[model samples]
Target chain A: MLPPALSDKQTVPFDDRGLAYGDGLFETVLLRAGAPVLWRYHTDRLAKGCRRLNIPLPCQAALDATWQGDCTAELEVLKLILTRGSGGRGYAQPDEVTPRLLSRRTPFQPSIQRWQQGVTVRLCDLRLSRQPRLAGIKHLNRLENVLARQEWSDAAIAEGLLADSEGRVIEATSMNIFWLQAGQVFTPLVDQCGVAGTLRAGLIDQGVVAQRALLLDRLAEVERLWVANSVQGVWPVTTLLAADGSLLQRWAVSDSDPFQRLAHQLLGFA
Target chain B: MLPPALSDKQTVPFDDRGLAYGDGLFETVLLRAGAPVLWRYHTDRLAKGCRRLNIPLPCQAALDATWQGDCTAELEVLKLILTRGSGGRGYAQPDEVTPRLLSRRTPFQPSIQRWQQGVTVRLCDLRLSRQPRLAGIKHLNRLENVLARQEWSDAAIAEGLLADSEGRVIEATSMNIFWLQAGQVFTPLVDQCGVAGTLRAGLIDQGVVAQRALLLDRLAEVERLWVANSVQGVWPVTTLLAADGSLLQRWAVSDSDPFQRLAHQLLGFA
Candidate 1:
């Protein structure tokens, strides 16, 4: 018999390891036309993360059945979090482990004006720590991202780019970034840190970009810059600034950024 | 009016950020005869963690009322967790944030034999990342400790010692470690990584030990080693080993260990 199906407005047990120690993995999926987008990429990452963290994969049948939840909206975000279930008050896993899958919904709304005109970003003083074990996968322990995102409260700054302790640009606070230089597209490698975003994966699979380590200083010479994620699709970065608002790199936006146009076509983002 | 009182075996709302991004802090206190051990240290750390993270402190009146929750056992463990409650999508804090207070209890049964006879420990392959924003406080983003603690399953080895990526000796999987050299006790400073445990703070407050940065190679020259926490009291270290089980340092436990005897008195750990 299968375990319980996903329910709406449910309460998490206080004993969940997800709350206790962040011992889990999560996927934020964009649902359009009552179905999940980039499902294969999401599943691949989920399977990979569960394997690496030794959390048993939830039943595929049960997971698939939850897609038809009472979502009548044309577009929405569905969050799938798989925790290592409840364990006693310690870090050690019990002899028997049962993974808990929790799904929640939120209304999806992306700013068309920001995507069209492009947006500005600033360098975050907070540096992401390098941990190869948790490098590419999106795990529940995202205090670094939270801390980095909170560095700015201004609505003018769309995102904050985070570099590692060694001065390598890993990713933005909540998205993966790419740059075009010499007619070649490059994205930072996640080998040392940063989440290997599904949108980045899809772009690489389509051969639209190549993976290379980019340092914070090298961003100045790039011809064009863009940030992409599953939810917000892709956005052109107009200006990149240091922590003190000193301009580091500037770019012009037109109807003609080849990489940005390609992302719009691929993700069906108008 | 005061907030709702803590309930045993309760449920956490699905939107709690404690599970979402590991955005919170926790303190584990030993309840002896319905009185919390190290109450002042626990509150001090909790208040400091909240101030740093900007999470509001819970009502002290409500907190004190819950400490007597049907706990009849002479010794038990009470875990108090404070989380940023019910956030919408993304990392930005809500304009009006309500912190959630979750408390649970467990049976406390420290190994008398292990505490008296001492225990063996091995170096963990997983090194703690250095994040000063997260250092010293016992936050909910503990994936590093979870990974380090799962490295060994042998009951013979009671704990795993963790060092920072810079090779600075930091702490153990679940406790703070101290070493004595030339009649001076020193513990690795928590400014870079590791939790500033309540027991460790108590020891420092009593002038029993001083803080110092230690390299992993320096463990060999230490005269004696011990690990301490609120729940388990203290345990003497008999041997320290490398990840491959190679002996790195050895020590002899004696009943006349002044440090151990003092901790026993402070914590009332028989």
Candidate 2:
């Protein structure tokens, strides 16, 4: 089903609660092979987020009208943004409100080489604060991501992983993190913090990776690591380094590993 | 001096960093008579935030444009939104870009009774995380405030105060706070977290309040308490209660107190 369609033509008032307070949720979908990749999952997640944020779900008819149809080209991305309609200047939201939905298309092509060659990452000095209420959903409060992305200048560092206040590894700046431990794949739990990435959910659904509470002291034991997101797929980590320029860990994806095969199969890589 | 005039037909790209990643800074100015209140301080804070976030600072002409219009309707509110502008789909911003500046107008009327009569407050269950980098600036990453405001449905609670992970009172959801103790006023230090409110600075500048690290344990000793922001001015807190209905403290501003006079004089309250 297509998500609700919205544009400047829609009567979204300037006083939108979303614009005033960022009280909204959004999802980015991979438009591959002329359709939104895993659209059902994306919409389901958006629905769940709306439920959590107390936003009424939009009708399927309204949602279907959002598709641009020009997205038949491969390597395209679609984003759906939803927010509670305008309220007065105050924080108190109105009871009866129409949700604003906006959609847009973008051209994107994931680099298969980056996944196979393995990317380098650095540790961000900034730490994520624990917030159980707003955690796990792809809500718009992302100052932390913006700050972490600004931590490094070298184009070589592909991503920056963040830690919570207690020094526990949470996730990468824009993606979820997974590492090999005791011959099993483990990713951080998103209960108290962090977004539940769609790709991470796919991996966990396939029983390829398990969730665990990671400790800062366990970094030394992480053998091979990878970060996953819907857009980037899964990328291998070549070298992990601290902000002080000390090497932490490095890894290469085994060609015969299940994760590598799954990734290659999903992305159509030989 | 009036700020420069803004482009009336300017449109923000859907992929703008401000929309996608909340990478932006903002200032809410309270207009008195025909001009903005505390314009210099707001601009200074915005400039500081831009420097910290590595966003481009607007030129004098562009800055002046934010307030170069008629604003005489008894009371008015102006929001200056400065964004890093639009870019391709990635966290890494493009080089050689001009930040987008949008200034919008709102209606506001000062309620001195809310300030003088003292407002009721509730302790929010949501805690502000300590992020020293983005702590003081009124940047767009405000999921905490949105959630804190959602914690209460009572209009009687003018503001909800938040605490840090360690259970120390930080500030109200959108304002800075001060508590009177032993004929001295103390406000929490925002070096590690919380916004450095313009009104808070004015109070400190006028020698009516002192800045210090405040703890939750010290609330019981406060003889009077108040919250201040650019828009709300100074509001006395007559009763403070936690989320679980526990009494934290009681405060009031005596009609004859010198501090009350100072607040009225500083805020231009009648």
What is each predicted model's overall lDDT from 0 to 1? 0.85, 0.76
Superposed by TM-score, candidate 2 places the C-alpha of residue B204 at a distance from the truth, in angstroms, of 1.5
Q: In model 2, which regions exceed 4 Å deviation?
A: A1-5, A8-14, A68-70, A263-270, B1-7, B245-248
Candidate 2's residue-wise lDDT over A4-35, tens digit each?
A: 33665532344555554566788887877657
Candidate whose TM-score is highest: 1
Candidate 1 regions exceeding 4 Å error are A1-9, B1-9
lDDT of 1 by residue, A109-206 (tens): 77788789999999999998888888999899988888888788888999999999999998998999999878899899999789999989999999
lDDT of 2 at B172: 93
- Per-residue lDDT tens digits for candidate 2, residues B135-171, read 8888877777876777887777889988887778889
Please give, for residues B1-270, the per-residue lDDT of candidate 1 as tens digits: 235334345677777788889998899999988799888899899888988788777777766755766786888888888787777448887877787887877777888887889999999999888889889999999888888887888889989999999999999999999989889888899997899999889989999989999898887788899988888978899999899989998899987888877777778874
Docking class of 1: medium
| Model 1 Cα shift for residue A117 (angstroms) | 0.8
